[model samples]
Target: MDGVNAATTDPLARIAELPGVDEAVAEARTVVDRLLGHRVLRRRSADVSLESALRGAHASAVLDGAEAPLEQVRSGEADDPRVKGALRVSGELGQLVETWPKAPRQALARLHTLAAADGAGADRLGRPRSAAEQAEDPAGLGAPPAPIEVEVRLEALGALLERRSSAPAPVVSAVVHGELMALRPFGWGDGVVARAAERLVLIERGLDPKSLAAPELGHLQRREEYTAGLRAYLTGTPEGVRTWVLHCCAAIADGARDSLATCEALKRG
Candidate 1:
């Protein structure tokens, strides 16, 4: 895969051609489609969506180092600002879905603002970090790209989102997620925002329109692989990019399985 600043006419289309991406994407689609067909979703999809959102937020917060149990998150006892921010971003995702493809940079700023509401000052909320500012390294991936590099990559990403492409939704979603993870554009809450953005892409692109699958849960379940995948993406090699995309596809399938379990539990009751 080319760099984020690549001049290709369709970056995601190129990504779709990466080895194993198509197979992984097909598997993820099969899982998600099966999840969409689960009996409980017909009558109790609202319940499932709510549960999925809560679980997704909780998992994303855990990735941010909040680490509360799901029940704690559900009962409103998890008061970590990261937890609160992840919940806020989850709630805001539906509203941002439509905005994402049209104006990705603006949508990202909105997500960062929601995710960093408590952690960042008023002056810093939604603002990309300046060259002098340092981002917190939650993934232990080391220092982020310099500010100018961040700007260029983000601009390129924004353009990619706004343009029409023939790539599969999973491919596009993986790219969006990987690029944001690598960029860490903001000083705070970039991880939450990036995960939220991935969900939004999956929703907007129709991979998981109701947002039932909790990919964050899948990522959390495979925490070591999650970190390793992102680190591989940061390496900018074809093999590394392939590994990251396959990891995301597997996460989507795992998340769908988790949602299916939610439906099953609801059915048994």
Candidate 2:
């Protein structure tokens, strides 16, 4: 609701105001603005977006331990449940974008349902992990928060999602991404849902409303850096959290580069 540089009580604003964030935000916006200005994107936004979603699905899947060559993903040859789950969430994100600010909990539940229905059991889909259900996770999310803690965090997160934050879209998106991953608010497919949520913020906040960027592709290309950023955020240090925010901004810029490449490929083909 407020400008990126606006002062607000929202904790996310502090992370956004960090030293490197302004430059990262500027570069990411500049790159995406250039991509959006391209004649090809102007005329064929839908087609290019479809292709971007395909790559984004692949990248999201890769982050969730479902690595596959882009060609394989394009051909529907990558059939792991994790990849399928990631694709499901990616496809559904556009539908949820408009409603996310109004009803984050419902939107998040739908995301969980889409991502974890196949592997997390139908009964567990769209719900938080139960006390009895909390066990060693198969998805390698590491130690998960307790059910009580998850519930508390969800309430806070829900409140935070009610409207736009003073933070820049990229910064807000990164916090959404990091918080979900760290909280693992749902029992399964937290990573998939986290990423889906980040994309929603980008669109809803007007950072990339056409949703042409392949952000997950950026994460896929630099998984090590991405993981380090999340780890830094988890450290609870201002410097660490700021590093993560900056990393996300950089990733979005890289995603814009991929969007430009996609435009060129589509025009050539």
Candidate 3:
């Protein structure tokens, strides 16, 4: 089928040209090992459905600031309702990862549905937008940007995902992040969608999404530097985007390691 031809000159290719992708992948592998090891330690009968609910709830909390400091969602704020929401989201995401091989399209659709629901104020976090207001917008959190010319970008992303031969995670993530951030489809949920979308990709790749070590969280951690990285991408050249991808890759590698450690500890206990 004639589709958007993903150019080797795309940002994913540019990321490969960077100095340390091999090292990043190697590090990512260690994190993956820990994740698998942790999973092995879980009770064989562990309720997959229940886990999914927990993960989804946690994801919601993080996106909604029902839980602040994404890292605290599991520990410090365990009792917080937002944390519970984030947990449910995360768990749901994990199950989706395990069961669904082709999840990107589904994930995107789900995110859009969530944003639309919110925009219509049907959700606790959503606000209302009139048909005219929704039609004229360019970028927001609850609905697609007005005029919606950017659906092409999403098409390009799906094409990239389909054509990837190997090393799909970083490539998929770089393209998805670039497009979503650029599109900013929903008024308030852009960041959440971007982050959640990355998590979805990682899970589909047979990696642990929770182990993502969340570059966005890291970005939040180093707000000034992270914002500068984002600004460089948004205002500078493609180099800025390349730099952000590298940073994100590094964050994922780091988060995987942390999750592995936590999983291992839990297993031992």
| Every model's TM-score | 0.96, 0.93, 0.66
Q: Could you tell me which residue pairs clash in candidate 1?
A: none
**Tens-digit lDDT track of model 3 for 219-253:** 44444554455555564466676666666666666
Model 2 is weakest, by summed lDDT over 10 consecutive residues, at 133-142
Off by over 4 Å in 2: 1-8, 134-141
Q: Which sequence of candidate numbers ranks them by lDDT, best first?
A: 1, 2, 3
The number of the candidate with the highest TM-score is 1
> Sorted on TM-score, highest at the top, how do the candidates line up?
1, 2, 3
- The C-alpha RMSD in Å for every predicted model, in order, reads 3.1, 2.5, 6.2
Question: Candidate 2 lDDT, tens digit per residue, 151-237?
Answer: 898889889778556778998899889888888877668888888889889988898988889788888788888888888888879
Question: Over the full model, what C-alpha lDDT does candidate 2 score relative to the true structure?
Answer: 0.83
Candidate 1: regions farther than 4 A off: 1-8
Q: Provide the overall lDDT of each model, using Cα atoms, as 2-decimal numbers.
A: 0.91, 0.83, 0.51
